[model samples]
Target: MRGSEWVPGVQAAASYEARWLPKDVMAGLVLTTLLVPQGMAYAELAGLPAITGLYTSILCLVAYAIFGPSKVLVLGPDSALGPMIAAVVVPIVLADGDPGKAVALASVLALLVGLFMTVAAVAKLGFVADLLSHPTQLGYINGLAVTIFIGQLPKLFGFSVEGEGLFADVKGFVTGLGDTVPAALAIGGGGLAVILVLQRFLPKVPGILVAVVGAIGAVTLLSLDDVDVVGPLPQGFPPFTIPIVTLGELGMLAAAAVGITLVSVTDTISTASTFAARAGQEVRGNQEMAGIGAANLAAGLFQGFPVSTSGSRTAVAAASGAKTQVTGLVGAVAITLMLVLVPGLLKDMPQPMLAAVVIAASIGLLDIPGMVRLWKQRRIEFALATAAFFGVAVLGVLPGIAVAVALSVLNVFRRAWWPYRTVLAKPAGVDGYHDVAQYPDGAHIGGLVIFRFDAPLIFANARTFREEIRRLAQAGPKWIVIAAEPITDVDTTAADMLEELDEELNAKGISLVFAELKHPVKEKIDRYELTRTIDPAHFYPSLDDAVAAYGQRERDSA
Candidate 1:
């Protein structure tokens, strides 16, 4: 725990001052009011009891208030990370119908994740989260969204159906169509409709909350206890207890830990960064990690599942003029009070309405505007986006996330396989050699063909570079100059291949020249005696210098 924290060791976050006006007390209430039901809905999405979400929301805020770097960001139970937790927990619970055992396993998993994140924070390894690129993340989220919607359909329709995968769930749902409770269905459908319509028209109207309340009121007035309520959630102050897990359960929970750690850290850090960016405040990635790390650990202790940065709720806090982490503290206190005293109020809340809230939230994450922007800027990126979108929508979440990740890896390989290599030429008034395509009919310095490879020289595309050089050399070019500015590092295989090419060029009396080599790359060449193999004089700082030197050498040879 950071010593500067107001709450001592319990606190997981650090603090920063807002240069402008700080967040007001009313703004905190506005965000809290929005978050109370959302936390429950997201908890249901995570395959945990509704109250676990409430516990997470409260504890995370308290933890973040103590340790959070950003004042405007709110930490809570997030729908985005829900599918991942469900994917991990459902299989385990299906095998053993013990809800207590499932909770135990999850608590242990959450604790481990907290420790992992805290360690990562101390090490300043926050950037490791970026290993999964944006494209892959998009695909993962898309897939999860579809998976969640499919899984929640039964709850939405007020039917009890069981299936492991999306297709199986859909099939089971169809088979059990007759069991749908009409009242629950009405609440679900109406809640979804109202939520969506309000989001579109009334931005600050608290649509989800209103829909939930309306659904509850409708269910109560119409006497629909025949349709299920979430039941009196295990409410009151969180009891302090250490998570205990057997070795077998721990082993089973490892994969969940991996998935949760990634999702939790990604959401938390991104939300913090987004809030900080909007407020023109500096963000500390390590501090954010520590905040989230403590939140997860606190949640685990409080019998809550894993928690993360809630994007929608964070935006709410930011928009509500939350100037400091105290807003989160206030929100936590508010939720705690709701859980302790008003537990009976939520006893008859409809499951379908919760499902509807989740559905409404998840659908909005599709990012239509972002896709449009990407489509106009880069068609290839747009294609990747479409692939992820459909892949999640149709194929399901697990497979969709898998496809997105695979696509990202493949994208990297594709660029490496056919890296941008351009032939350079000197234009009429340009300072040095530039890409011929970029210049208007630029001259090639009288038989000197200069080529620039824009990526690192490695085994993946070294052959292509070699082949192009040989072809250009054979095109009656007396000298071949490589503009090595963008080419950073070279592998041993590339160096060996270059050596072989150098011998071939020497025999044909065609000079191989290199210009503008980065110091690191130049050092590699020097270490390998590449400069000895090819004359040291051939190397120059500028393309013009190389061309002039080559021309002078030609004149001397003549």
Candidate 2:
């Protein structure tokens, strides 16, 4: 068995060297600085108590270090998953009126998500992550950023707004602006400004840590009473427990679990693939699914919620020269030490400052430049992205995700439903056949037409293919050669259509020929008896050979 197969963690540890220790230690320290604030921030974002973020962060890091395939991936409470968790958990908590029950429900949700991911890994269904295309993903995230930003605005101003959904939150925020506490607004605004400036001018500086510490100090020294703070946290390591929920709520929890699983796996694979590429390493998507599943499972059992790979945290580790999963291990240990030793250190930390942390992270999530590039390069994809953006921003997170997924599936069918087809001709100075639409000056051999269809022959597009072929035949060519290199598959419906087209052509004194047909596709056609109906001799190895044969047949007829 391979080292990774025998023991996943051993692959990183076995190659460890003393020289890499210092960088890993430093990276670990840096990661802890970010993890501490972001964890609590995202936890509250998920409608849980702030301390759960630390629990989620610590457990996920340690779990991922052991089972995760990537050397540098950082697993924790992510801003992207925050609202999603809140959307599912908060409603149940409000209905039950029990905080403990809410935590259990969140844990159950995480456990379900982990199990789904594990099943996907076992089934090698990593390709499901590609259900959302690049543009759709971009738009969904941008929409998420907007959603998160709007949700956090009232918190930043030290006011509570009770509302459901994105628009309702927006409405609450707008009306609640009058109730904002000046101290909270100042701290949140100042912290956000400092983070942005430091990131812009001195990126190597631990800007978030600096901003968080500064806010804490200001709140303490100023004795700020009006500002909302994180208050005191329970000081200890996370205890293990199995989540219990009523059987009646299982169906609702399962739906939420599926949503979380979809987003988490897709986010983890994309982040891992990117960092793995930068490190000149390959990413095992299925393994990543299992690793993230293991991490979420550990978190759920430890009184934490579902977690996913954090691209920002992973980037921090990579930039700080992390060498292995030891970075994550060290970071987890550091957070544990803080929880045990300095649980009250952030007691005066303003809640708005935490809100600022989330806002800063959300800002990074909006890929405006990427959206612009998409708009300029591919207009239709841009439209798809726009649709997803509106779907999330207007419809709410869960509904938006459903809309994005539907759009992705529809985009696939839309392309196949009316795929590109063209006539092929040899340009005077070119050696091979080119699309006549693109090369209008190209020559078409007399009494023959070379046609090309640019997609697999599937049930969806079978009729369209037949119609196009019929239209082309109306030109009354004695021979029609299909440039079949692009037709990768011929399904049962398509094969049947081809057989019918062949017979019709033969009855009209025309021969249907296939050129550049792939072996598998030809085999499929032969299995359907198309070869017998159309004559096996009519197949040619290349478009040029088919053209030569057409020339010989014309000479013989003359």
Candidate 3:
């Protein structure tokens, strides 16, 4: 690949014009407003210090700006990935009783995820993301939203809850409700309300920044010692760090790494495709994998955890009229400046307010409207979505995602295993064969039946195909003409089934013929020598020709 092709930042820079500079600068500023609060909130959500969130944000932005394919995609610590990070790292943290060790483990996980993504990009395995179908993706995200919301409720109420899973978390919150600090609750609730109002009525405003600043002001003026705050942040750029872990922990980390890679790549591609569509740009999935891989690699090396493309932040940038990756670079620079000049800007920001920030973001992840649409449009898909929701809600994040992937793959096989098959006949005033059940008035030739099987003849459905053929033959038709246009391929098992069916039909004094057989399918039959067992002349290029030949044979016999 050429330099321009591999490095999207170089391409963006070459095409840079003065006209876009002002817009990009403004977009960057607007993005920083959300990035700062979100970075910290998600970092804490991930079982890491709030400062690491800022580190992840800065490094990922700069790295993606240099490598990402999309002009507007904003990479950062994501609400969705936070709980997953926590799920994987929190247990290790408890085991070691050291927060630093947990952070190191997460960094190593990020590195592994980055390597997985990079390897996939190099191998052109972008289609691996397709393992999660649309329905499964919706279910997983909705479940994640519920999990995050429940998981953060304890923090939002100004208390910590100990739990093993989503249900336990909810139970812990309910039981500990009496222990919640009134001051903390008031500050957190008020902050959340302000943020929600700003988002609903004044979307263009920087709601998170306003809410955080207001909470800080309230804490200062009232001397609210009861409310938990983030306290002072370490001042300076993120230090270069190497993630260290024991060899025994490598297998566990590898499993977590796979989950992170799946979620990160899927989210990145979906987000990139969405923004690209709006901008009239084509999405390169493989390139995006490489780009996000580079960003994660940077984060892992810079005291950060795994990061993903953030839909909310990306929308902020796009809505603010960002023109290029320069927007991300500007945001990175702005964040670095804040760390240098005002590292303690959010020192008095309440923990509940941060929880509110994260909870609000997670709320956006729920697709209730999407679920409704699915219900109205496709009930089976809605069911699949519901199953995925329960999978995550009950089984926990990692296992739930695994179940979703399994369901997605099974859905594909389920369709192939029992695909639609129908008897076809020439309908009145119709030019071609139609399903006899759907078109009851259609006429079948005196001694011929036209059957249509609407899927490929693969191993899974081969027996079904053979059985259906036998059943249609029992209808007493002297000849069976298969409308094979829908049959794309005939696997070895299906070929053997076909050969056996041919012999059985011949023994019953019925001849089997195939019409509109695709060339590739015909070649498979020929290769299997099934064409010799039945007559090679039984194949026809069109249904009409097959019927015509059958009619001529009947007339010659009469």
Candidate 4:
């Protein structure tokens, strides 16, 4: 068993309750229907043969059910990641156009992603997800949806052209508009319409599946063999094979691998957390990381690209009342049956219809309510959200992710490197110390300035800390008291600088006192023996004790 197997909030999944079997089976059927169309469409998105998406969907769910910590999360190929993978693979595939080479490269990318996730899990670095702030992710995903929706349009029109970026893709579409394959456009566009209509009224009726049957049947009746259909996909299980890559190729794939991995982790964590919350459960971050790692590992070994949790499939399971991870297993099994029994069912699936499948699914990923909540509740978050959204439009999805990461990192230092430093004094009704800004006009003892620092003392901000203290105490208080409760840590460089400050203050006949410091901090000061040079008598257990001691010392001197 893995170290995180006994994760809290996941015990419910392990409980073998026979009574929940009916609910689980019912949920399974619902998710199975939804997963079918999505798996195929996402395969196209990943720039692999449509069948590889089916393989990824089958194995990912099977592995996740056995290893995942969340009960409601359904593992499958995702719409959100489809275009991102396409953006990477399409260019490569178009360059070579070798089906074997394409499959090999995809498998390699999955392997690299799996290894990366496994390393992150072991290192407990799943928190690296924080690099993308919620605001930035919001913007990036929304922008990705736009790019994907547009990219699919050309395919729906049965016109194939190539481009590297969003604008270039639009240009290709315009240039190819004159040569639009009428048969391809008819099948893809008509299929898309059928799906949209069915989704509105017959959501549980496997609309995409229905559309596939109708489109293929119509094309067959019309004898339109000239139209570019998906063609006969292999009707068998995926054969185990390794992706071949040279060192030179690895460096190029790294960017794609890193981008896909980031998006995968982001999707997995968010979806798992959502489902866990629904189950009144807490997800094990490392366990979830390992589960996703295992899925990608399987994808790499077989012929597939990188994958993540499909929000739409998982939501279908939850909404259909899936009681446990059983639904994910069922979905995987259904995908296997499709491969073994009916691979040709999707050979004629219209490309535009496939695009519609993705577009419809992406509609749910909009996150309008969440963004609205932020708008009403916090302006800063709203600004971040908008910035990220626009950034994705201008900067592209991967770069937009980078933007989010940068903002999140800056936020951490923005407060720590320049924290609040307030002066305090005791009067009446109030306690030992209060912010001078909050309590002006209050009587002061006149000989002391007690300033509180709200963050740890470190080299990055020590100079700033000293400057604030100096400026605030220029009123010439005989004693400078540091209400050091908030500050619980310091680096060696900071400790040495404090000693210098102690010496400088002593020469000016001003006493520097420290109070309410955590025990660990006190130990460090003792380690440096800073107490030998400064007045040990100035240290106090509490702010009250320090203030009272100062009053007593003044009375004794008078």
Q: Please list the residue runs of candidate 1 whose C-alpha ends up more than 4 Å from where it truly belongs after superposition.
A: 1-24, 372-376, 386-403, 428-431
**RMSD of candidate 3 to the true fold?**
1.2
TM-score of every model versus the real structure? 0.92, 0.97, 0.98, 0.87
Per-residue error for 522 in candidate 3, Å, reads: 1.4
Each model's backbone clash number: 7, 0, 0, 4
Q: Write the per-residue lDDT of candidate 4 for residues 1-558, one digit (tens) a residue.
A: 554473422555557588878888888987776777778788887777778888887777776776677777887788877766666566676777665677777788888888888888888888877677776678677777777777777887877777666787788989889988788788777777777787787876667777777777877789877576777888888888877877777777777778788888887888878777877888788778887888888888888778788666777788888878887777777778778898787776666667767766666567777778888997777877777777666677667666767766776777789888887866578655788788886666778878899999998889988787677556777889899999989788788888888787777777889999899998888898888787778889898888889989899999
Q: Which stretches of candidate 2 lie over 4 Å from their true place?
A: 1-6
lDDT of 2 by residue, 246-343 (tens): 88788888887887888888899889889988889999988898889988899999999999999889989999999998999999999999989999
Residue-level lDDT tens digits of model 3 in 82-164: 88888888998898888678779878888888899899988888998899999999999999999999898889889998888
After superposing candidate 3 on the true structure, give the runs of residues whose Cα lies further than 4 Å from its correct spot.
Answer: none
Residue-level error in angstroms, candidate 4, position 112: 1.5
Q: Go through the candidates in order and give each one's C-alpha lDDT.
A: 0.77, 0.90, 0.90, 0.77
Alpha-carbon RMSD of each model = 3.1, 1.4, 1.2, 3.6
Inter-residue clash pairs, candidate 1: 12-67, 13-67, 13-68, 14-67, 23-321, 23-323, 143-397
lDDT of 3 at 177: 96
> Best-fitting candidate, measured by TM-score?
3
Angstrom error of the Cα, residue 360, model 4: value is 2.3
Residue 454 local lDDT, model 1: 88
Comparing 3 with 4 on lDDT, the higher-scoring candidate is 3
